[model samples]
Target: MAPLHSKSHTSLGSRKSSIFNFIQQPPQPDVYYVGVDVGTGSARACIIDTNGIILGLSERPITRHELKANFITQNSTEIWNAICYCVKNCIRESGVDPEDVFGIGFDATCSLVAINEKTDEPMAVGPDFTDHKENIILWMDHRSVDETIEINSSGDKSLKYVGGQMSIEMELPKMKWLKHNMPGGINSCKFYDLADFLTHKATGSEARSYCSTVCKQGLVPPGVDGSTTGWSKEFLLSLDLEELVEDDFRRLGGIPDKNGTFLSAGDIVGKLTAKSAEELGLSTECIVGSGVIDAYAGWIGTVAGKVDNPTVSNKLDSKNNGTILTSCGRLAAVAGTSTCHIAMTKEPCFVQGVWGPYKDVMAKDYWLAEGGQSCTGALLAHVLAIHPASNELSHLAEASNLSKFDYLNLILENLVVDNKSRSVVSLAKHMFFYGDFHGNRSPIADPKMRASIIGQSMDSSVNDLAIQYFGACEFIAQQTRQIVEEMEKGGHEIDCIFMSGGQCRNGLLMRLLADCTGLPIVIPRYIDAAVVFGSAILGAVAAEEAVQEHIHKKGKSRRSSILETQRSQTSLNKVGSGVQLGDGQHSPYTAPTATASTTNMATLAYASTQTGSHHQFPTMTPMTEETDYFNQPPQKKPFSDEDDSEDEQTLSFGSKSNVQKGLSQKLGNLSLKPLTKTTDTSPGAKLWKVMEKMTGPGKVILPSDENHPDRKLLNAKYKIFLEQCYKQQEYRDLVDGVEAENIKG
Candidate 1:
């Protein structure tokens, strides 16, 4: 609720000044930028200076409507209001003069916002079509699963960019569902990805971001997939969504005859509108940058922090030695209600089940891939809520003034002490959890997958709850390993992970993640605010652009004024070798070289001229068998009595002595040691200078020793984890076969 972490250059001697006093104060010479992030549950705003040091941060919860199962919706109006509230509060808290706020950037969940074109009012997109208030289809909503299946069946070339499968969570599937279900069809409605909607709200520009369009709406960039315009008209026509192709795809952020302006992350959209400025308590001169999905913002916020490890830092710098830069090697895991694994590469890597190899999403000239888990923090919460000892654990945690997670971690440590075990991990030696309660987003890409738990007991003690919590954390870590492995198999050379989220606060999770993945986990300085901070970085870039524009214009005017004076003086008097000014110094003005605006304009012109034929879809390439692992049938294993009786052998919590014996047996010869330490060998140099300036250094947690005994245990457990995943598929196959036979009979 309070400012997460603030570093103020100005003295706080007058901190108690009223809001009016702060507004009336003269603008600071130093410029500030504001970043607004709209997550699933809340809207947050933070004000940062050029150095990317946060001065103030505030958040406000928005209303969510779950009208039915898997039908989550929100009101755009309420979300905007919450954003305005957070911005105003952030400014007031920071005591920053509104006029000094030169730019603002926004990032939100990749949800769909529908607006009526004629009235320019929020249009309903939900179970109750009459209720116009709920205009946003929340990103997590799965009401469009059937539509997703239908679209994926089209086998469009555009689907290749999204890992050969279109997710139901993406905007296109939701739009299809709305078209089929909504009264009057969606012809009169305009759809904006939530991030684009936020930018439009701020600056009144209908322009979209490449991050949103290319990643979610299946808009292939000009150079990729042999498309001229980003939109694939033939693909849309094949899917029977002709309304989107009409009006030059205007409703879907496409321009009629010309290529629409789809700005990259750092590009400016426009200046803030007067209405938006007043609402947000900022100046109208403030520029609005193109927005990105929240997770992409996290990638921007991290990946650039100075790594303390020399080995990793060297890889971040060298280009010739099989080493990739930070943008290519580092993966940003933005975890909150869910966790998104974002990585960028020099070329597109078509990883199956991952969301993208999207171009110009987070950074220019880089391809971005997004793999995610649909539920993580939410999964942990559900696990705790369903446990019988949850209330008791909560009460104990409250009394101790600790969070439930922290308290559980402490309980696990105590268990380790009492059992004389090497580490708390021993307590969960036999426990295993399959964490796909909301479904798997990556590697498997199956929405129907459910969660499973092994090694359960009738005892509902707090100790059992602690073990359950540990298993959940382990599941998150193991799933992360699985996602990383899939990405690597697809040709991504991931080095270390840059994680930013609420989950970073949980040390046990961090440790388990490092141990499970065998990669160092870099924690950003502002762990909880990294995504918002990344948005602030975009705002900073926009502000820098505005300043450059001002300088260019001022320089041009000064040169004009000086030239006129020089000509007048030369005509009046006889000069030396040349017309000399009074001070005998040369003019300081030089013509402004190609700025970002001109370069962008040139790019647009090129794209407009290169409008390739839309009638033909590009030749589709089949994914290799090894890379398309998700499509392959689960490997069959011979049934055995041991496999059938494995559940019966699970340790029961009813007896402490038996539990200890089971843990020891499962752990085998495992012995715990402190995490492995690595030393810096190369000269420390920053790789991403701009990002490093914005994000600063963070703590690094190295993985356990590769040769440790625990590695063997964890490796074996991971095998079991994979087995459980295949076991789920086997169950589904058996049931499906039964249904088919029944129909025949």
Candidate 2:
């Protein structure tokens, strides 16, 4: 591996060629895998062997120019040029013939790119569009504050899916801002997110990833009732940017597809046309994959599956505990310039201040909710680089022969050790850092907020550097805790924390996370290269090849597969018996491995519509006659002929301490708390019914304070969430219900 710090500031050197050692000849000989990742400053390329090893790696810096205080922009032509350079470098380094390369995949930051497909020219974004081709909007850009407020105020149903609010960082706000401010550019342009643009440019395909549209843009996936739609025509018309709803909504991304299902990347998307081939210095046969957002690629690479540890020998005993335990349950913070916390759920959840429940966005059949801060490590660097003590620290680091980050960490470590009474983890207690410096991305998608530092002193020495460093780390962890807390309130119960990205390597930061969240942190063995491997897997899958199989060791099968092999001879353990899935709902047909009885047949309520309908009951081995409900109606008749799926949230309560234990210790105390009492029957049932009446179809769930403890706590917490977390019309309605009840009484 190369040293942590690059010797020179320019580009990666000839070591790129040595990476070819990992390249494997494909079974079909013509098949290959490509992985592309776009970071805050550049786009990188990697070629991986079929076994998921890096064969070749290359990179080219992307051009990002700042126009104003918070405005960041990039040139599409420049980005494409960088991509071409990296691809050519990869082919040259690996010495792999382009024709032998079969599939390719890509992922980039969720930036916005605009172009005129007919003229194939860029449209202006601001007064500084001199490059004409510099029409791309960087993810870090935050110039549409008012636009975000307007969209949030409209209380669009699509907004609820994105945690009940909209932000300027997302594409719709930017699009609306563009149309209202620059009518000419809006008229002349066809809009595409940065990832969508790269894929379209490479393959001449317009398909968008559900990952991008559902997460960042206001594209709602098909719900349980099976209705699908994009930005509302009426809403856009009301906003006076109705032209976007024209052309059947071609400008923004159309119906989005799952990641890795589109045209494969390695096989010639369209043989590199002569013009493009000449510029890229590659054979016409080079293939390109449908690209993805950078963070999603990280999700594809690191946490998709196949993570194993020999030291972790114990298996979870409870049926339901195993699924959440075995799965990577930690918040994955893709920390670099910014930090994003990605959490997954078996069912789709609409958190009031979180990002998604985006369908099939990353892992197929799973929903994802992304919470994050706009800045973390990058903000720290930017702040420290300008500090007066930085010059002194740099001089000291040069003398000590250490990188600046290492130097700062060492100092903080010494201080923590000397004090003995305090730990670096507790630094945020004395000092707090507001997330608004780059703006908050989650728990509040408010961009108008600015970063603030509390408990600063006039000390301009090395200790100042240590304090700032410790403070920054603490601030990030607190922000992360806040996000996790919000997710829990929205009904997501996460246990461990999984970390990736370069920043995850920092021991201080990891310990800080552990201290704040009080959860064990799992850092995957392959950290930096996870995204590359993930994209390669996506490419492999798109090419009609099996990639999930590559996640395990050569002779080892995945947990599901292993269970299948043994199930015929011995009774297999069913998921969710001793373990809780929130509400009291359990799959009766599930077999238990421990001191529990197996239900005769499966009847699972509260399961996601997508997976529950088609999932086959897990068969326990040693076939015995048991009643099968596969084709039978449910045992219980309808209590009320009403669909209460929205109110069907179950509360699975694992002790806070249980989350910190090892597998065996953790599995000992699993308890199920089913808050299954229907609000329709409770005293608060009438109040909830009244509140339901106040809400219209396609409206959001709101809080009301009319009833006793249960309803009052719900409304108060929800009111605080809306007033302090994220505001929407639904929140106002909830508050209005509280007032209306007080007067009536």
As a whole number from 0 to 100, the lDDT of residue 169 in candidate 1 is 80
Candidate 1 structure lDDT: 0.68
Model 2 Cα lDDT, one tens digit per residue, 241-263? 77677666667754433222222
Top candidate, metric lDDT: 1
lDDT of 1 by residue, 1-745 (tens): 0011111111233221311012111112335788898887678888865445566677766778898999999999999888888888777666566655768889998999999988889999979988999999998798988889889899898999997888878899999999999998988899999999999888888899989999999998887768887898899888779999986788888851374678878678898876887788776668888899999889888887654444555566564332224467789998877789999888888888998889877655668899998888777778788899988976786666555665676677667656766556767888988989987888888878999999998979998998898888889999999999999999999888998765665667777787889987876655567788889877876666454443456434332354356456543111101111222221101001100010111110000111221111122122233322111221122211111111111111111111111110011110111111223222111113335555654545667678866666677899999999989999999999999999999
How many residue pairs of model 2 clash at the backbone? 23
Q: After superposition, how far is residue 658 of candidate 2 from its true place, in Å?
A: 41
CA lDDT, candidate 1, residue 155: 86
The pairs that clash in candidate 1 are: none
Candidate 2, superposed: residue stretches over 4 Å from native: 1-31, 68-70, 128-131, 183-185, 224-226, 253-288, 305-330, 363-365, 416-436, 446-458, 546-745
